[model samples]
Target chain A: MTPAFEKLQKQLRQLPGLGFRSAERIALHLLVEKPARLPELVEALQAAAATVRRCPRCGNLAEDGLCAICADERREQGVVCVVEHVPDLVAMERSGAYRGVYHVLHGRLSPIQGVRPEDLNFEALFSRVADGGVRELILALSNDVEGEATCHYLTQHLPAPANGVEVKTTRIGFGLPSGGGVLYADSVTLKSALDGRRHYE
Target chain B: MTPAFEKLQKQLRQLPGLGFRSAERIALHLLVEKPARLPELVEALQAAAATVRRCPRCGNLAEDGLCAICADERREQGVVCVVEHVPDLVAMERSGAYRGVYHVLHGRLSPIQGVRPEDLNFEALFSRVADGGVRELILALSNDVEGEATCHYLTQHLPAPANGVEVKTTRIGFGLPSGGGVLYADSVTLKSALDGRRHYE
Candidate 1:
């Protein structure tokens, strides 16, 4: 590989979901396989970088002032789903079950990893809640120790109830994934699923 | 996801080895998780685009002029190993076995896929051979129908021997991969390995 190719591969390797082999593949694809696509990708990256911004209300991706969800009048703004990252919010949206707004924490609380409440987008969420725009706070974070810590921190640090605006905090149910089998399910998932079992119809 | 985010994800998905989930993850990572990396990646891409180019001699990646292998005097330039793509050349280099120069065809003969010799870097390779720069040509292409067709095309189209120059053409040995077992080997690989068997010392 040449210097420029190696340099580009190095940068690509640092990107999420890309390792050495993947990076090499991309570099070769861009430089050798499909040279015409290179400029298009660069233009797209530049355009996205120039336009994409965080929505002030929910911290979701936005082209300008607010994200589509926060700007939508029909969405349940008061029922804010707090997620560990934007992808989680996207996942929730993809399910098409939740029409509520989102609060992207960007990351969960991880004391071991030195991530604190102040490091995340907690202040924006707190302000959003404090503005009396939210009534229900659904914690859709991960089912891990860090996720639990983040949920606990969010519930504890919520703005005190005022003007009859009592924010009802809740966590998403943890259970076996759809189409997953109990026989192959991990102990943690099985335990969580059993604990979260609902009444028979 | 916002318009800008979606645009970036669409572009990312078009790249080699990326899929829907990977595109979404990379989009979130770049726009929300680590925004700083986005700009750095953009810079690297621009730099690579501006600097990286096809080697005039071998079609491998080059910064300005000849590729490292083609420019190196120590390498056996007369013994040219032809490959279907740059990645294949990189694989060969990584193997640390062949010290000869390379000629990247960029593609193999695929009639169904409409790929032909004119669509590849065959002219440059033929010219290189015609110039009496090559003495031996090693076909390091894949062991498939298209690869065999490409080998056949190269051998048939090679410039006739002239000026006391007779180019020797050879094909790479096909066998079970290192660390692979006969039980797990595919029938094609097993047959090739058996056909290519050599006497034990």
Candidate 2:
């Protein structure tokens, strides 16, 4: 293959899921097998780069003013689902369960990884909470130590009783996933499921 | 996500191995998680598209006049390996077993799929054969019906006896791959392995 092809392959190999062989296959596919797709893919990348930006209000993807969710007046803007990333928000949306707006932290506080609070998108969320419009905060972060630390930081720094309106905070339930059996569930999940069990008639 | 992001995801989904969820993850990773890599990927695609082209002589990837393999002087110019694609040629080179050169056909002769000889890169190979320089043509194609048809067509139409060279044609062996056990091989592979068995020491 040509040098440019190899360079492209190397770049592709650095992506999240692509390995060296997968990157090579993709590079060969785009360059040699289907050369016509190269321009289209480049155009798509350029278009997305130029048109997509983070919503200043929610940290979700936006184009002009605000993201679709934040811009939608029908959505319950008062209930903010705090997620670690835009994909997490997308997953919550895909579940068809939540009808609230989102605040993407972009990352959690990971001291081992040298990711501090300043490295996250916490400023806008703090400002949003201070605005007193957010009635509730839903913690939809991962079930990890960093997620717990993030939740702790948020609750500690929250401007509670903003303008005489109490900002209620609730973490999403951590239990056995839907369709997961107790035998398959880990000990931690079993403990969480038992701790968060609801009353059954 | 924005429309442009979704469009990019759709384009990625159409690639060789990526599916809907993987494409979505890639798009989100590029546009959100690691936005810095987006321009790099775009630049790589544009650079590869602008610089890389098929070697008109052998249909291998090339930058300017000829591919590296076609231009190398140390390789055996009299021996040529015919493959269905550039990746196939790369595989041959990776085995450290091929010192000759390659002719990438780009596709096989599959009339059922409307893949005729005209759709493939056969003219350059035929011209090479007609030049009386190729002493042997190794058909390193797949072990499928289309591969057989392609081999038959090549043998039938090759400019043999050109300048009294008596150009020889060969099909690469189809047998149990190296390190592959007979018990794990399919019936067709077992049959081919049995038929092509060599004399034991």
Candidate 3:
């Protein structure tokens, strides 16, 4: 292998989910098999790097001041879903189950990992809540200990609703996923599913 | 997702073995989680694109005129190992099973895909053989029909040995792989293994 080829392979191996063999394959695919596609990929990467920035209010990917979700007028401003990462927000949107805005915390409360309140996108969320339009806060975080701690922390620190009314806080449910079998469901999920069992027809 | 983010993800999905979800994950990882690594990857891609090229003699990757193996005086240039792709050459080199140089055909004869001899690096290989230093040609192509057709084509088109000596051409043996059990081997491999079986110690 050439020096430049090896260098490219090494850099590719550092990307998420790519191992040595995959990196080498990609390097060869770009350079040898389809060299014409290399310039397009390079341009795309540079364009993304130059333009993509964090959304000011929600911490999702943004090209300008605010994210599309935050800037859109049709989205419900009175409700906001809180999630651990941008992918979680994307997942929620894909489910078509939520019509409100979102606040990406960027990470959850992981005390063992030394992440604190100041380490996340909490201040903008607090300001958004205090600005008085929000009436509900949906905690769509993961069903884990850290997610619980984060929800607890958020509820404890929430400011009074701008209209001097209560801001309803709720967590997303945990249970067997749709199309999931009971045999594969873990113990915690089974417990939650049982505890939160709904009335059947 | 932002326009730039989606564009980047789309470009990533074009790479070998990457699907939509994995491409999205990699885009988020590069742009949001570990952005500091982006510039390095960009530089590596640019550097490889600008410098790496095919070796004139063997068609392997090269920074300049010749690849490392071809440039090395110690490697046996008299015996050339022919493979279908650059990665195949790399795999053979990794195994440390051969000391001879390599000729990368870039692809095999695929009539359905419209690949012809002119579309490959066969002309340079013929020139290398006719120029008179080669003693043997080893075909390490795939075990499929295309590989057999390519071997047959090469043998038919080979120019008379420049030194007026016979050029012994051989195909790599197909059989049970090392550490593979006989029961787990496919029927074709079992048949080949049986056909190529040697006397026991």
For each candidate in the order shown, give its overall lDDT on alpha carbons. 0.77, 0.79, 0.80
lDDT of 2 by residue, B1-201 (tens): 789988999899888779887899899889987889999999999999999988988999999999999899999989898888888777666555568888989888988889999999998898998888898777766666777788888887887546887776666665846543222345565445434533211
Location of the lowest summed lDDT over 10 successive residues in candidate 3 chain B: B192-201
TM of each candidate vs. truth: 0.81, 0.84, 0.84
- Second chain TM-score per prediction? 0.83, 0.84, 0.85
> Residue-wise lDDT of candidate 2 within A48-147, one digit each (tens)?
9999998999999998989999999999999898888787777667655567899999888899999999999988998998888899887766666787
- lDDT by residue (A120-201, candidate 1, tens digit) is 9999988877778888887766666777678778877888645557887766655746533222345565446434533210
What is the per-residue lDDT of model 3 for residues A1-201, given as tens digits with 9 covering 90 to 100? 888889999999999889998999999999988999999998999999999988988898899898999999999978888888876676666655557898989998888999999998998898888887778787766666787788889988887767776677766555746544332345566456434533211
Worst 10 residues of 2 chain B by lDDT: B192-201
lDDT of candidate 1?
0.77
Instruction: Looking at model 3 chain A, report the run of 10 residues with the lowest lDDT sum.
Output: A192-201
Ranking the candidates on lDDT from highest down gives 3, 2, 1
Q: Once model 3 is optimally superposed onto the true structure by TM-score, how far is the C-alpha of residue A77 displaced, in angstroms?
A: 2.1
Residue B144 of model 1 has an lDDT of: 67
lDDT of 3 at B18: 99
